[model samples]
Target: MTPRSVPHPRGVRLVEGGADVAVYTESAEAVEFCRFDSDGNEHRTRLDQRTGHTFHGFVPDVEVGTRYGLRVHGPWDPANGLRFNPNKLLLDPYATAVEGGYDWGQPVFGHDMNNPDQLDESDSAGSVPRCVVTDRHSFDWGDDRPPRTPLAETIVYETHVKGFTQRFPGIDESLRGTYAGLAQPAAIEYLTDLGVTAVELLPVHQFVQDSHLGEKGLRNYWGYNSIGFLAPHNEYAAGGDGGQQVDEFKALVKALHAAGLEVILDVVYNHTAEGNHMGPTLALKGIDNASYYRLVPDDRAHYFDTTGTGNSLNVGHPAALTLIMDSLRYWVTEMHVDGFRFDLATTLTRQGGDADVHSAFLDLVAQDPTLAPIKMIAEPWDTAGYQVGGFPAEWSEWNGKFRDDVRDFWRSADSVLGTVSQRILGSPDVYEPTRRSPLCSVNFITAHDGFTLADLTSYDQKHNEANGEDNNDGESDNRSSNNGAEGPTDDPEINDRRNRQRRNFLATLLLSAGVPMILGGDEMGRTQGGNNNAYCQDDEISWFDWDAADQGLQEFTRMLIRLRRREPALRPEWYRRGPRDRSTPDRVQILRSDAKGFDPPDWNNPTARTITFVFHHDDADSFALLLNAAENGVEFTVPKAPGQEWRLELSSDDAQRVEGKVTTLILEGRSFTLLRSVTRKDVRGWARAHGYEVSSKGKVPRQVQQAFDDAHR
Candidate 1:
């Protein structure tokens, strides 16, 4: 846990206890200490150059506002994640902030051979950019109360900082598309209105556009490739000196907190901006390639490449672990971030460069009280290894299975026998174990890397021609059915079906017991235009179009979220039976569509497409949610209770208002609805869901039909 800073030989010439901070250059041809002030003027930092290009020193006057850059003395090594050119300045990964967006040129490019094995060809770093010091943080938040909303009650809204605020008319146009923009009154109003408790911003860490992307006149829009864990991306800041980015980000966090919203950052620790072994080397590679990266143990030149991002962070190293831990703590204590959702988090669970599910990082997080209170979410998988349900207890994980099941269920026209019930009820099969609460599964259908919810139901295949990469990069197996069309359509039949499917999926997402994550702009029906891998487009293709807002979809989304909050049954934290369990033969009943006297309906019966859940809760009885995904509605009889008369509650058929405590007759085909009663009553504790027997090896028991039939009265 102690931070260990490795010494660079002849690096920084410590002048009387290192004035504030110092930079050491051991291997640049010529060293230059160009210092800039907050006003971008020529600020001076004294330099002491050791013979052989070691320009190491400190600026006596270099305090928080001191902005300085160092020119190093090494030939650029382009392929090994090191781009050390004595002439070109490099951004400090540890710098607190940065200002101004990057416009690529010879000054920013490395001159070493594109292949590291090849000799140097040109001087590429004469004018490369530099990061600066910052002291812009200002807040009087003493004993600031974090929202303290439990994981069970947290509904995360995964969004892009710029995209969320870019189109809002209320955010000042100048502040639009910046970190401060997210804290705008208009944006806060919208998020609060939607009942979102947390906002998970796509990676805010400083990053560089991929070289290939730059070659193609593209920019890294999503910000996944990180260069700075401690510093905020300069592009995201409205305006600042090189060091105020982090403070500005904290200001945004504070503003969000004021709105009762928690900010969970999307962190990418799996890899750096450095791509595979062939990437330009900056700090890690230059400092110690063998130490900072997870190199192939036996084959030093090669790497495991678990994350597609090339050079995976050598998380097994104590120094690397310390860096990550320190960064996380700083965000929590300094920035006041509510949580982190690690991208490609599985890579962190490897020790000694091998992917071990219960590695040291995972162990530390599981036991670290300081880090545990905040939300610890993992994407749960990477390209090389996907350990779904792999991390230790207390860590909520993104359930990819939840996404797939929900998508297939709504999009599946043919018989997907047991998908609807499984997904609608918190995906118990995936998260219910070892007392792991239902909220453990972060249920999300569409995320930043995919088509939006609207597009998922509209585009069966991706349309990524604009990427200019031959459309071969993104995923092809999208479990989407476009209602018999490729993209856009005018046919009312298919369009209506797509709209209804959207509503159903949204409702199911909010009502399900798991923690729901609404992909940003999904409520407004945002679309990637079928481009799933839009990492390289910082244009309109990746930006959320505010002019194209779907008011109806947004309102539909609002009602679904409101209903989820209103009904406690919809958000049960745990399904384990409790003392006040509502189970009674007189008041509660689970009847199969064609069964008599509470007998299990013939589940294998494809024709029997509808199952009526007849039950009651406090406030009223006679509540039923009839599900019929088939073409024709079937008349299923509900055995009359001796003293209880059935009154109409709500049905999916009534597109207007189909909720509350009331009774109803048969539900319609290809639809699901909920009904309620005027009088309070007890409901069935156990549902007619596919029951599981305790199978060996901690796996869910197969959905046995006989066990269900035995529950019949």
Candidate 2:
């Protein structure tokens, strides 16, 4: 039958009697759509229709669940970046469902192993995975709506799908470590109870496991090496991955939204699983290598890799941009995801080997109506450069400075007072010049990349020897401290210090003015046994241990989250300067331990370890936060309020003591204390009527307290 011309839709779409298949390639001389039967028989048909650069055709009897692959025949010139071998069977770039894994041998590579310039004629049909045709709009999204939590109120929980539920006690053993496991009632209830507004899952895009790690008997647990952009990782689906993984992922999103939780995906679009020149011809490389990847201007044989990955996507080209945009829209419209957090996002903005604010990729995302309202977050850096506040005003960023400053402050590093204050105030110094609100900073102390919260407070050095990199795979300057002991210790003082430090970090993160993201297992004291980089260890080192959870720390984290949710003054929508006058009511005051406003010189003082923040909101109760990072306890003079007395709400130190109507309190070293202002009119009136001689501006004496209690009794 003569193939019909269909160039609009890029992927295979279900029609009445058949399927419409389209693949975009600018350099291919001929493209063939190949299908495999249940018995592994190959039937090939040429995509004879071509409009501009897109090659498309219609298959008469193609149905959903059909396994298919693409084969592009073109020039094999390597020096000018045209690598096309018809021997390789490539997965569809827009495949919604991918089946099987790579065999990871010489057959998968397009070039000869010994000679780089020569093409290998070995067929890769048995080595690479096949794309499964799926009905994109077949999932029943009954009355499902995205939570769309506002940026200011968002509390992000960065978690791994398999690691989060692999050992969860509430879910079934079969469903554990799958997409179905996270959608279960147990996982949903736990998140709702913890009060986080969104769950920022790590990469779920279909990826390739590294062959090197396979040789070491390890797996790529992080899921960063993506091969299929529109498909969910087959290993994460509980159901078989012929096409059921699509519906299962959609159900997971629906279940999360029903529970008032937003699902934010940590997407990887900067690079693909295919490495440099020596890498496999998985999908795009076999389709159109010159158009899809950024190659060196003079040396087209080499790739311009800014992502630390072997090759970066050529976002400047129209072909690559279209693929990325299509994949993003498919996730939002078809898959029902709420937002995205781009990994190594800076690499996407490099149009000419330098990060540009006006790049075509950012421009496309800014003006696209479907993506305008979606919460777009950028990792904001790559292996090349760090662009913390470099994105547009409409986007938020993972604030690396916030993490470093908060860690340094808690560790009592000198000259960090100024930066820590800036971090606590939503990083105005970073975002203010860009005219962006405080919500633009996604403040997080720990994430999937670095040390877990428990490990951060227990080890000063990274224990990444398990990563098979000779203890050099992770970051050396972790900004972490072991307090007193290196590993587990019997010393009660050291353990107590470590526990207090954990609370300190959590309190700082939740109470700070920005969008806070808590590492998933951090609340329950999940330790990696000092392994800061456990990307390869998918077992106990990375999984959450429910049996050994720290219930006390969990309760403390819950309390902090509840407090953050309850207090409006804790999270401001925008950066606010001090009130014009005292009566303005909505303001923030940074005061020293002596209850005096900080001067320019005081902020520069390296010895200044004690600081206080007084947050005054117009509609909520005023709050005062006291932080002491000194080696010894410091007595803080409470700021005088005319008709209000400070009531102790929460403290990181369990042994902290506070009496009624406190005029002065000694905060323990490396501890945080929160106090709310309570009106003392009733008590003061009672004291005055009983002739207790209570002063209007000073502390109410113990005699008056006793008399008031006695009279009330």
Candidate 3:
């Protein structure tokens, strides 16, 4: 009630007297903060004080869990992007928690349907969600600390919060498909077992299930169409309403941190659920349309749509930038999330009609103390242009080139050998000029927008008809292969080949030099039945199947990740510049099947399918990787050390582990193998050193077991 009190931050801030509510709107003629009682009756209060662009007011005796929204009275001129209609209630842009879902049938449009030039007088109080007054300082973190896994050592696991646990048998039925489900013992155990340091959840922010999807009896399973940036999606919380999501989300973060796992949210700050000028007025559009969205320069009635989402948020505006920054900080300081993956991130860096690395948004992130240390990832491209390695040194980008090259190599596409080499070697051609290390490139073969690992090797084309788009919605060029037959087959050979290819892709992803992000259920061979784009298939098509999981593939993937962690050579801190000498630390050597150093002529040979990589680390065990993608088996000349022998560690062909002296290795077609060098004395004197514990059965001793545990730990 006092005008002299300092204005609270955006959104609801509980004060000693009542609550201080503040909202930012530069062009609104009048801002009315409306609160609704449990019976749905509304009490309106006009904000009496204004400082700069922020409007603030204190409501006396107002308790927590109060449902509120805003009604802005301003000029409703769509042609100039001044769409403000008091008849439609708007959710607070800074709302920490939302209380309801959107109804398409409700009169939520700011402009009249029949006469586009006139403003609609219909009230949207029943259709829009209410922002709740929250006390974010109440949660007890109790010594919870982020894992802060170094980027070089971070292995990301991309998963959907609800789809990840919706059918997980080990989780309680009541908690399944909720935030609590992700923190369940089984879920943590699974992530830890998979050896991933971080989990990049597909959009947990409050998102909209598009009305078109609703009409087709489908839902936005990916949750990319976000409307609320500061709030966690209320649907993911197990119980309670309003601000309860704040506590539930914090609890999830605590649990993940307790298990040494980081959480990264896939954020959609590039666009909102509110589409183009024809779309409904939700929050930003109804409050300050011109300031929030980027309208066409010559024609304000249309939007400067770069995200293909009909409208793009006008980050060019300081208020818009502040909104994004505030939301990010709230998630970090208040909700305790580890990082964010900006979807269509290039759009955010566009200033003056060009993607500038020194753009205001990136500069804000670089200068901010709270955001600089946290993990920042960028999808790195928008619908307008691709800026694959254009992000600054402070951030890591999803290496789209890595995905395509890895897929091409496994699919046996021609002219892929050269591309694959550069990709798996941390993509020096892309990130070297900036002096960035391997961690700058987040390597992933499959992501949420495309096919699952199983489907990638099982179907050559996308079967997205289930998405109700007549198979025209998803990408056409999948860069995938079916090997022999499409879909599920009864032939043992075809099925076996598919499984081998899957393992090959997974091995390539984990063993490559960079941060590898594994698609969550890919370890268990989770499939979308060939639906490469399952954005709208919220049913069984998108939900992870727990009962029929491929345990073998899961275990194989676990082994691969463990191998990656154990061998320091696999994950180098710096970009490899070739071996200075044989004894140099972190030496990288590329070779052909003939044991010859990577010859320039051979690099361009289309028939050159077999390549070997020898990685040497002074502080850890060394490894040699052999890749064969030809039609016939190839005999590779094994490199020999002066006083050491090579030991077969793992093979994609199910080859038996060989321990005796070997001069040459023969790999099967399209298979790979890993070899480790051991001192000749250790191999010959193993029985004597172990005192008969090491039998002729070729099993490693307890020393190796301890080493393995230490590597994984």
Candidate 4:
């Protein structure tokens, strides 16, 4: 029987007695499906059917563990952006599971290294990984349900699968550094105990290990360089990679969900592993260069790379958009992922050469039914431009301003008090004009790209020499301080200061009004030895040293997380400001250390190092936050509340309490304190007299508090 044509779903789908395969490539003159036997012998069959740009065919006896690849025959004119060689076997763009690693040399390059314009005609089948036809529905997801945690209450813990489990002693030896490792009871318990709602994992997409990093005896620990968007990275699977990687990843998601944790993937849809004109042809570049990538208008030979990864996906093209959308849907629907944090998302919105809010990519995502309900977050910037608040209203962004301003305030940078205040209140200046809520800002002090929390307080400068770039790579001007001594100092004073700074950052992040994303291992004081960019260091430098974890810091973080969860006022859904009228209970208020409302001059004061925030929520306890980032301790006069007394709750410095009717509180240098408002027993009598039901010995009801405010008003 002749192979029948089918073209609805893009990748290989198992049918009765056979399998149907399809690939989308508009420029390919011919497409051949090559299946490899156990002995590595290739059997080539040309796909004779075409529907629009999709080439498809059905092959008999194509079983579930079948290893296969594609060879697209096309024009080799490089100047006009056509560099496809039939000799180069490409992995399917919609591959669900890829089964090998790249050899990474001249054999894998589509064009000749010596002559860029000429095709190499070298067979890359031996060098590049082949796509495996997986039984996607085999996983037993018994009673699995997504946590679907509200974005406002989300506490994202950004972690790498390998790095998080590689050094964890809680799991077995074989399961370490694998998907199964993360699903173990110990891992789940740790996350649940820490109070994070979601685990925003670093890229699990099938990524190519960098050829250069390989030459230098290092691996891409971050896994940002994606080649197969749909497939889970095979190396991360404790099970074998033929088809087990898919099931292993699904199991991970199931386990996380069972533990009431959401899984948010850090996806790299901006670009593929293929670098540039001189880059390897492992996948998209070899399949169809012009259709998948954004090539320069004048010079088609080169790419218009905004991602700084040598190539950007052509979001303007339907094929590229379809692939991305398909990948996203597959992850959410098949893999059961809760959400996605798009890396360099701004590049995907550049449909017309500049990032547009209503770009095709964003519009597609907005209308996609499968993706609409899932949480979508954007890194919101690219190498070419910074678009922090540039994403559409439906999306939250990795607030770069929040990181910078918070760092500046803690490090005592001049004239940042106003900006830091804006950040702490959920960056209303950035998101309010767009009519977005406070949840639009995902507040974080340190991320995977920069210094870990421990290093942020211990290193004034980036020490990235171990990355082999001679300290030239990674960001400079980190707005970081070394306290008194740099890296691994024995000075108790300096160590104490660093520890205090970490607490301050954690407190500020959790207590602020927005989604909080803690860098993984930050609670336990993980460090990369000042290597701000540890993407390539997969060994001891990147893994969490559980034995050396700072247990004190971990407990402090847990306290902050618990406080954040217990108080709804800290994570508001909308932008809140001081009350417009006296009758309105103030949702938020900024004040001087003397308990006076901050004037315009005080906001702009360059030397201002101390500030106070008064927070009131209808459904939770009220709080007063005192922050002093100065070199000397400051005496803060607590704001007076008639029926409530200020009780010390949490402090970064030595704990101290105020006795009856005492309004003064002393905050140490570069420290923060959180005070809870305790209602006086007489307030219950006042509530009862006002005809409101009152509880005699517990916290006051919100209605009672509101009634008391109206009475005062």
- Largest lDDT belongs to which candidate? 2
For model 2, the stretches where C-alpha displacement exceeds 4 angstroms are 1-3, 577-586, 679-713
> lDDT tens string, model 2, 547-597?
999999999989889888877888888776431344455468888999998
Candidates sorted by TM-score, best first: 4, 2, 3, 1
Candidate 2 lDDT for residue 174: 96
Q: 1-713 in candidate 4: lDDT tens per residue? A: 65566897998888877788888888889999999989999999888889988889887768889999999998898899988799998899888998989898889998888988888977888898889988888789999999989987889999999999998889998999999999999999999999999999999999989999999998998999999999999999999899899999999999999999999999999999999998988888878899999999999999999988899999999989999999999999999999999999999999989889999999999999999889999999999899998999999999999999999999988888899999999999999888888899999999999899999988889999999989999988559977987898988888988989999999999999889999999999999999999999998889999999999999999989988887777777776743233565668888899999888888788999999998877645678899999978999999875347666778889666655466888888899998877445546767888787876677888778767655642
Q: State which candidate, 1 or 2, has the greater lDDT.
A: 2
Indicate the residue-level lDDT of 34 in model 3: 92
- lDDT-sorted candidate list, best first: 2, 4, 3, 1
Q: How well is each residue in 1-713 modelled by candidate 1, as lDDT tens digits?
A: 21222233222222343343334333344445556655656544435534332244444555555555554445544344334554344555455665444444443434434544543434333334456555534555655667867887888999888877776788898988898888777888889999889999999887776767878888788998887787778887876545556666877887888888999999998888766655664455544455567876666666668887777888887656766876787688778898999999988987665567679888877777778789999988887777666666688899887888667665544444455455555665665655466777899988988788888878888888888889988888558767668777899877776776676667668766679999988888887888888878777877788888889888877877776666655566665332245463332344565534333335444444455544433343344455565655555554453222343333335443422222334544455665443221122212223333343333222343223223431
lDDT of 4: 0.89
TM-score of 1: 0.81
Displacement of residue 233 (Cα, Å) in model 3 is 0.3
What is residue 554's positional error in candidate 2, in angstroms? Answer: 0.8
